[model samples]
Target: MFVTRSVSDLVADSEGEGEKLRRSIGPVALTALGVGAIIGTGIFVVIGEGAKLAGPSLFIAFIIAAVTCAFSALSYAELASSVPVSGSAYTFSYATLGELVAFIIGWDLILEYGVSVAAVAVGWGGNVNEFLKATFGFVLPDAISKSPSEGGVFNIPAVFIVLLISVLLTLGTRESARLNAIMVVIKILILLFFIVVAFTSFHSGNFEPFAPEGFGGIASAAGVIFFAYIGFDAVTTASEESKNPSRDLPIAIIGSLVISTVLYVLVAVAAVGVAPVDTLSGSDAPLAAALNEGAGIPWAGGLLAAGALIAITSVVLVIMYGQTRIFFAMCRDGLLPRRLAKVHPRYGTPARLTLGFGVLIAILAALVPLDEIVKLVNIGTLFAFVLVNVGVIVLRRTRPDMPRPFRVPGVPVIPIIGILLCGYLIAQLPWETWLRFVVWLVIGLIIYFGYSIRHSRVRLGEKADAPSVEKA
Candidate 1:
């Protein structure tokens, strides 16, 4: 259970990097992938929920979350560069911690990425319906456009987007990266348009009493809106696919976060400036609501709906992309069936695993109530981030001689702050979310003991290629 993979083995595995998967991603494309994933459902969908909790000070929550992620991103960049592995935090833990801890984080990440994709898909359905109603003035019946709890049969658009992204992923990695770049550009433009339009009606008076509920409110909202920052780490999962995981992964991870943090702050300010908290938080589509009713700019609201479609489409693509790669890594490690790790001959991608998980996620998006689970997802990702930060400190002590392309400036201090901040956020979540997390972990432990232990390549003393950022 305490077995560890030697760092030498990982460096050896990354040596001839493009054997199984193609390495076509440069820093620009890789950063775009991170941006594509980071700027999705959180900003477009859940920001309203945070607005309700923090009022105009929702922007403050964005800052808090960004600062926390900024610290963790440093640690993530360090481990990501040194390992250049596919599993993100899971891979790092396997090298620094031990197999049992690595498996737990892997299970935790599987939940975080899989559920987030499904939740984002569900939110995509709402945006699709909003766009249709605003443009065609015709709405799909609730029966086919929402979950049963929301007075609908099933969410068709959610499943449709998931299937579409899955197909795109099956085509190839470079193809997906190209499309993600295009979407990232369009979405950024859309956001800038929103900011310009929002400023047209900006009211400084709307920000009176900004900290309505005080730091307590901002902290609570930060716990919720931290969901917005979830995908930055998703960049590290693509290290295997990057042309230079050591150089590019750090750049992509930190660059994507910097770009996204600026947007999040500007958008939050514009949103509250254009409308009162009561009005913006009243509806699910805060940005649109701020435009259509508060700012009386219906046309801009309509266009914003269209931008959301493209934005969320890329998010699903990148997140599903990350999840499949993590699954591929786990399987290749023999913690799951190794055959499932095989890439498609022509596409150089994990075609079957991508499509299989996409379909399952689609089914979940259609049937499950995902709104409440956002916090559950937040706690899981936070746990993974904590492990990654801890992995950095452990690796320093365990392998002080390792070469690092980029190092966190403050060593143990920065990583400790990350762990503490994450712990604080985790504590802010409800007890019920903790209960669900414990149950999930219980099930994962069963699988680990019953199957993973026996099949694990490390425990079996089997020789296999180490997973790296370079695809091949």
Candidate 2:
């Protein structure tokens, strides 16, 4: 019966938990956190890879990804406002979808947060290495800076940054949030510089064969570039801290998506304008390289490199924040150890989980090559987005009268489009990516049946009279 409580009861339960903490974040800061998490190394590095796969149609790919994200954000906004909890989709899924789905979302979230942190950390080190060599006449030895896939040694700087951010996260969320805002400002300013400089060297001839690679190529690029819009959902993690969650949570989520999409389009346009598409496709740092071509400024590349370092750092911080909070929620539900959910006595943050994730991510960043794990992150994120969209409609039918802070304006249509778009993009990933996703799910099943099912707080209590676990 407790497991099948009404939607209002779940909301009340979340409030009881969340109100113990202070609500200090304003809408602006929340929006900045969203932006800080979204606009980073994906634009700097992966956009080029997307272009290589999609051609000029990569622009359309951005729109496709953003629209899909917008649908999920709408669903997220409603759930965040209604529950005002720390766990984001993990909490929402628990209340409405059941323990099994919640566990899968939690498992997929590991990719979203943990894997992403390592990938972004590696990117940060690469950019920092470039800037140091150009400005200080010092180059990090290949033994320390390069990923093994790149034919060098371990990425020491990346591992170092992850360790430092983990310590900061343990110190406090409020402090980490402030630093994230500042990093967001720095990243945006550098992107604007690229936009301004690249436009000056615009050549109409560069866009001649816009869709050189065909529609299938464009679809694949959308799969790859889908990662660029990853952070919009991070806003849901801050739901517990918003002053007026119902009014502000949705605004922060949707607003961040709209803002990021525009910025990405501008950056892409500027990048394509300043250089040939083929040239840009091959670049590891497209925006910086484009600015160097257009403005003839030797230092433009250095500035962009500096921005990439900060941008990647901000992303690592925000995602790590999300990871710990999700772990905290799972722990409280008895799906994980309760000790992992304990908030710091002084800081009021999940220090144990934060530290655990930090150490795990640092180890991952140190040993795993970046190219090996990026696709797994992409597929996991898309799967989560699919659920958010489906869950929106399910919740609507099951509990329509529940208070919705921000309803999707075109509920059925929007969610439907959201579902098809997510499926289409998922279809474009390689066979191995699907295999990896299946393996991840099977492993999650093992843990769930082996541990979570037996230990779950709901299961440990008297069995609810209402239905089976699937229906519950």
Candidate 3:
């Protein structure tokens, strides 16, 4: 359980590099990538459901969730600065925890990123159909626009969008980051528009019984809202591609979380102020509904559909990119075929891995019924959070003098709080989700012992403190 990879080898891999991942992303682009992953379905849709549980105090729930995320974010920033692995929590686990735990977290991340991309793509297809119908009086047939579970033959739009984003990724990381930044700005503007429209009918009466359901409800709502913050850590997965990783990675990770949390709180305040909690919870399109109900704006629904289309698309792009990078790191660690991690000579990206996962995710989106499966995405992410917080404490004791560009203040204390908070959220998941998670971990153990353990670079006499020579 404690076959840890030496930190020296981890750092040495990126030093004196020849043919390797390039550092093309700056701090601003990296922060945009984090924002793109964060402000999607949570703000646009999940806020309504959270309102159901927390009543008018849904704003408080957003705060609770954001605080929980902040602790984890600090831990992530610390590990990301000092460890500097593109595998994110998975690599962090290896450096401090062990290879077996790393494999478990790696497997968990695969489920989180892959399923999230598919789920978000499916959502994008729905919102785009609504946008097209509202704007052009045309909608794709159900057969091509939805999964079979939603009564469609094959979701053509979902598959098409995934492939399109995949192509953008294959072109280069910098190109994809540029497009993501533009989409992030547009979506933030659209959300700001909603805030403006919602305030036009702000009523003090909406605050009469803000905590109608009390602290119990607020905590429950926080659990539901926790999933929305999963994508911020996706920023750390781009460490290898960052121009100045130690500085930029932490800023992107924490800055995105802080920016996203403020937006989340402001939007929640605006939403609850515009409508009663019951009314907010009743609608599938709560943000748009609030605008129309509050200010009598008939076109608000179309505007929001447009926002959802862009917002969810950026989420898919960023999460899918994170998944592929983690795969690249794992392959490089010898958990999988090293050739699969090859950087494209022209694009300087992991084109092959990115394209392959894109196609697989597209198929999953088109064919799979992911309603229940999507629940696993949240649990998987929370599990990684638990491991990351744990890794921070473990590494500090193990490597007291490691150079850290960014450090989590009050060592052990902050990380312990992070672990406890993450555990509280994980407990909120259903017993069925736990059962499924265990089954998934069981499968991961099988793969690790059967294959990964033997092939791991650290286990293959590659654990020397000195850096290995890079091949051109």
Clash count of each predicted structure? 7, 0, 0
lDDT of 2 by residue, 70-137 (tens): 77787777777777877777777777777788888888787657888888888788778889976787
Q: Write the per-residue lDDT of candidate 3 for residues 265-363, one digit (tens) a residue.
A: 988999989877777899888988888787688688898899999999899999999999888888888787777877777788888889999999999
**Order the candidates by TM-score, highest first — what do you get?**
3, 1, 2
lDDT of each: 0.85, 0.77, 0.86
Clashes of 1: 7
In order of appearance, the predictions have TM-scores of 0.94, 0.91, 0.96
Give the runs in model 1 whose Cα sits over 4 Å from its true position: 14-19, 375-377, 465-472
Native-referenced Cα lDDT, model 1? 0.85
- Cα displacement (angstroms), candidate 2, residue 333, comes to 1.0
Q: Candidate 3: deviation at residue 210, Å?
A: 1.6
TM-score of 2: 0.91
Q: Kindly report which residue pairs in candidate 3 clash with one another.
A: none
